[model samples]
Target: MKRLADHLQPGARVFVPGLCGEPTLLLRELAQDPERARGVRFVGVQFPGIGSADYLGLHPEAQQTAFFMSPSVRQGLRERRAELLSLDYPGIARHLQQCPPFDLAIGHFSPPDAEGWCSAGVCSDFLPIAWARAKRRVAQLNSSMPRTGSAFRVHLSELDAAIEADIPLTTFSEAAGGSETELRIGRLAAELVRDGDTLQFGIGSVPLALAGSLTSHRRLGLHTGMVSQAARALDEAGALDPDAPITTGVALGNASLYEWAGRHPNIRFADVRSTHDPTGLAALPRFVAINSAVEVDLFGQVNAERNDGALQAGSGGLPVFAQGALRSPGGRLLICMAATAKRGTLSRIVPSLGAQGLCTLPRHMADVFVTEHGVAQVRELGLDDRAEALIAIAAPEHRAGLEEAWRAIRNRL
Candidate 1:
């Protein structure tokens, strides 16, 4: 701990792996004595519920910056104790590529293999890139983190220091079985999927529900940004390709899934450069991309990142998948969401996005819109037809108002 603290000086910036790769023990030790590393900044994205934000709250000199928002860090940003940087999923690798030499890079990794290589395990998102940019690299060799034969491997000799910790890897519980609306949306979205389709399922109740609905499909292939428990289930059910590997940039699931991934030779992890590359994704035959959004306007603009004016999550890999699916030979991009939000009071299918609405996926890039009511194939549709199709999927209570709003905006356009 003394040696770790000694590496940090006032105003030094350190890079910490977020998601399932956060080194809990190392971070806890650093938080214990903030005086030793005053004015130090921790940079990362989507930190799970660790005390990283709490440390920022307690120590005025310490700062935390994130490229994506998680619950804990989002709270800190709201209080003006932290800052947020805007970047997409693939952009994460580019951000690390451009980062000035970092003071230290800390993360969790699997135990060294026979060849003295440690895999980033559940998270291979940007650790390799961060490692190249950091002046020092420290890792917690956790037995719990499953090694998925990721290309993001580092030799044991490369680490400046290694700490052994056997803590359980962080798990994101599945959303309580999707609501009636979500289930209906899932069914609608799943109907678009066919056999031999390579799939990209985003994280949410809707996607999980869609995965459940896909149990009967055959020969499905996975090439996604994040592999969830649902993807494992599909593979277990023999729905996925028997010989082809399930490719993902990150894994976010439970202990059982982690162990399963470790033993499964078909679970192959790659970096975002390969996973989210537009040209590479287009080459996959019959790709199907299903993702949820916070809102979608009549113009087919998808907003997955904001609520009213508040930041919800980052753009993530949705843009990449959407464009990729559109370019695939027989691909379909389904942007799904419940018809309403705020306890079913407000329509998620709006006339136009609110002032702060972010077009995570542009109107032309979208293919299908799914909700509880029905599915709307809006790709290549004109403004009036697109509005009509989208409004038809809105909740019955909000349909009339949405139509009126569209009519007013239609004339203006």
Candidate 2:
């Protein structure tokens, strides 16, 4: 048992595990004594609850550079103490590997096995690569972290410091079973999935609802970014391959799901490079990628990273996954979202996206669009036809306005 200071020097750039893999002890130490890390810069992605807030709140001088902004980090951004980077999921690994390597990579991990190997557990995102490239590596070996079957294992000999932490691993409840609107969108998206399809499910209620509607499908293979309770259910229903592992980049769920993951031998975790590479995903048979979006315009342009002018999340692996699904034989890319936002006042399906909207997936790459009203298969349609199809799936109240906007654009063209 050693303090983080014993292994880390002050004013260095450190990498902490994002999402559920955050090390409780390490973070608390930083938060409790920010001066210990006064000039240090912390870099990572989404923090579930107390991520960065404690440290940043206490030591505003300690800088933060996030790949994917969390709610807490967003607050820091508002306060002008943090900044977000624009990069794909796989690209995060590449960025960290560049010049002036990270001073220390700190996070949680499973205890060393008899063979002296420690697993990355629920997080396999960029940990392996970060550990390799980092000048120092510190890990909190927690008994509560599920030992997922990830290839990103570091031998005990590689660790600069091993702290035994008995804290509970963070858990997330399954997203509330979708709203009426989400259910409608889910049903339409679920119809696109076929028997023996290799699936990639994204985060958010739309994808969760779609998963809930997929129990009847047979032989679904998972090559996704996040493994949720839906994945566990699919595995139990015999919808997934018993031989081939459900390849994913991260695991996010409650304790029961964690237990299931620990017991299941077919769930394998890989890096973003392997899971999000379009070339690799295209090689899989019958691939189907289901992702959510904030807004999608008549052009089939997808905006998943921002809304109303402010950033919400990152580009993540949407582009690569969409491209991969499109290139796969018998593959389909389904973009699902509610037709309206702001409590039904705003139309998500508009003639053109807002000015701040970043095109995560371009029009030429879109495959299918799903909303509460219906599914729009407009991948090969003309621009006018695409607008018509998209409007058809928009909330009934907004369809007329969207049609008027579309006609105005067509007339000008």
Candidate 3:
């Protein structure tokens, strides 16, 4: 640990991996000498295991860079004490292409096998991105990280430093608690799901609740872009089809989900090339892709990103599934969510999206909108027809408001 931190010069920038894959132990040791580490800049999605945002406060010049603003880093970024650099999914990879990179890139890696190459574990996707962009690669080797497959690896000979540690990573957002609305949405989502249907969804209450309800299904498969705690619970309940092609790009969820994924026979962790490949998912029979949306305008445009002026999340895996599900014969692409948020203060079935709303899936591609109220079948509908159907599916409290918006948009009155 001492030797690894020595690589840092004053005002050095360090790239840290996001999610549970953070290098906490290394950061803690460096935090000891507040003066030496104070001026250093940190970069990544969010600080995973780097404890005490207070450590970075030692120096006013200290800042963190993030592709997406996470709640953990939100305060720092908001106050201008830290900087938030917004980049889309593809942009994140492109940002890694810039030269004259960080002083060192740190990551938690699986111990090297007989070949002397260490696996990047859950995030070969991002690790490769960072490695290509980083000036030097330093890894904190841990046995806990599953020795998963990858295209390339960091070798002991090439690494600037290799420290040993058994530190855990952090989660950006915990699972939203299952509510009556979520459960009802889940029940509706389950009706659309059938046997041998390949599933793809992100981490949230909706996915978890839906997965938990699928115990009776058979030959169900998984080729999702991400997995959540509900997916893990389904796996434990013997609902997930283990023998099938269970693929994923990342697992962002609770501790149980992380523990369930570490080299579990059922979970075959793979890269984006295969997992998020639209062509590949389209080929699968009975493929059912479920995504969430922030708001749905009258035109059926799905806003999965942004809320007001702030960026809530990125457009991840939603378009991939939407396109692929359309291509797959007998497949369904469904967007499921509660009818409203803010304690029913506002409707998600909006007359118009907030200024920050980014249309992730266009109206033409969107298939179904399922809420506790009803399922709005708008995939093949015309503009006016779709608005009518969407309004019908909205929660009762919000339907009247949405109808007025629909009427004005259609009649121009």
Candidate 4:
């Protein structure tokens, strides 16, 4: 294979894989020839904490256009060298379909199977769409990548160039034990979940802790956007239904989980259109969507994207799953978070989301709200009653102040 830079041209719009599918070898090669990459534009959806590649820093004139904000792109965003497309998972797929064809699509894939097909492996989110729309396709073939059965695959003949490497896949390890507050919140949230429920959750400390709390449950099913180490624990504990497949867009975990998923018959890696589609999710029985947020107001509105007036993340698949849960029979949308942040000095359950806060999920979409103190079922409650329920679950120290704030807000109404 020729050098990765040889395939690139100035001002090219390159589609790079994100998350665990990131082609480090190709990126390193591109970074090595900074002058050649000038005016190059890198595009993809990078998740925070999972991806940390500064593509814009490769050259002073290099630019990036991404769907999600990450630490790697934050500097470029502030410097006006990067663009953040505020689109949900499904919307992103649509954008890619309608946007101008990319000059090149570079991806990391598992080695060819008996049929000469390479799997997208741990990250199949949107690469397939981009791959189809690109004029040229390049792949970094890694033997270390798990050949997941249900992941998207590309033919060896489809690639314009291929670079072989043996680098380890990126891994994410959640802390073994969470804080006391997280444990309490997890336990409280777990109490709302029942056997035979189909689960959908995002990545975070609370969800990990919730997994630990649900070890005793039985026959739970998973239809989530991202599958993490927590899914392995559920399967091992026999909490997950043996017959149902673990449907997810991506499998993000350590090496052991990857190895397990490679041979596991029940793990299915799907595309975003299927994983995040509301209609498909609503068809599943007892679909329970559990997600965490930065804060929740008495009205049950959620803010998961921003904090302290700064953008921290993207819209993601949360809203889509919430809609599914709401429409599904016997389904529930559980918004789980600690009642306080910043060492208990601030209350997460507030009187209202102020002008600065971005409401990621509106009040009606949240069926239940869980805090360390307790769970508030606010879906059927009116405004006044909803405020009281949320206030009751607030931290003991903040309960009184929250009640006072709610009362003032109520008087204005």
| Top candidate by TM-score | 4
lDDT of 3 by residue, 207-265 (tens): 87787677677778888766667666667677767687578766765455565676576
Q: Candidates 1 and 3: which is better by lDDT?
A: 1
Worst lDDT window (10 residues) for model 4? 1-10
What lDDT is obtained when candidate 1 is compared to the true structure? 0.81
Candidate closer to the true structure by lDDT (higher is better), 2 or 4:
4
Per-residue lDDT of 318-363 in model 1, one digit per residue for the tens?
A: 8889889999999999888889989889899989987978888888
TM-score of 3: 0.86
| RMSD of candidates 1 onward, in order | 2.2, 1.9, 3.3, 1.3
In model 1, the runs with Cα more than 4 Å from the true position are 1-6, 47-55, 70-81
lDDT of each: 0.81, 0.79, 0.72, 0.86
Better of 3 and 4 by lDDT: 4
- How well is each residue in 249-299 modelled by candidate 2, as lDDT tens digits? 777777677778777788788877787777899999889888888899999
Say which prediction, candidate 1 or candidate 2, comes out ahead on lDDT: 1
- TM of each candidate vs. truth: 0.94, 0.95, 0.86, 0.97
Off by over 4 Å in 3: 1-3, 10-13, 34-41, 47-58, 71-86, 98-102, 150-152, 171-177, 253-256, 283-285, 354-356
Better of 1 and 2 by TM-score: 2
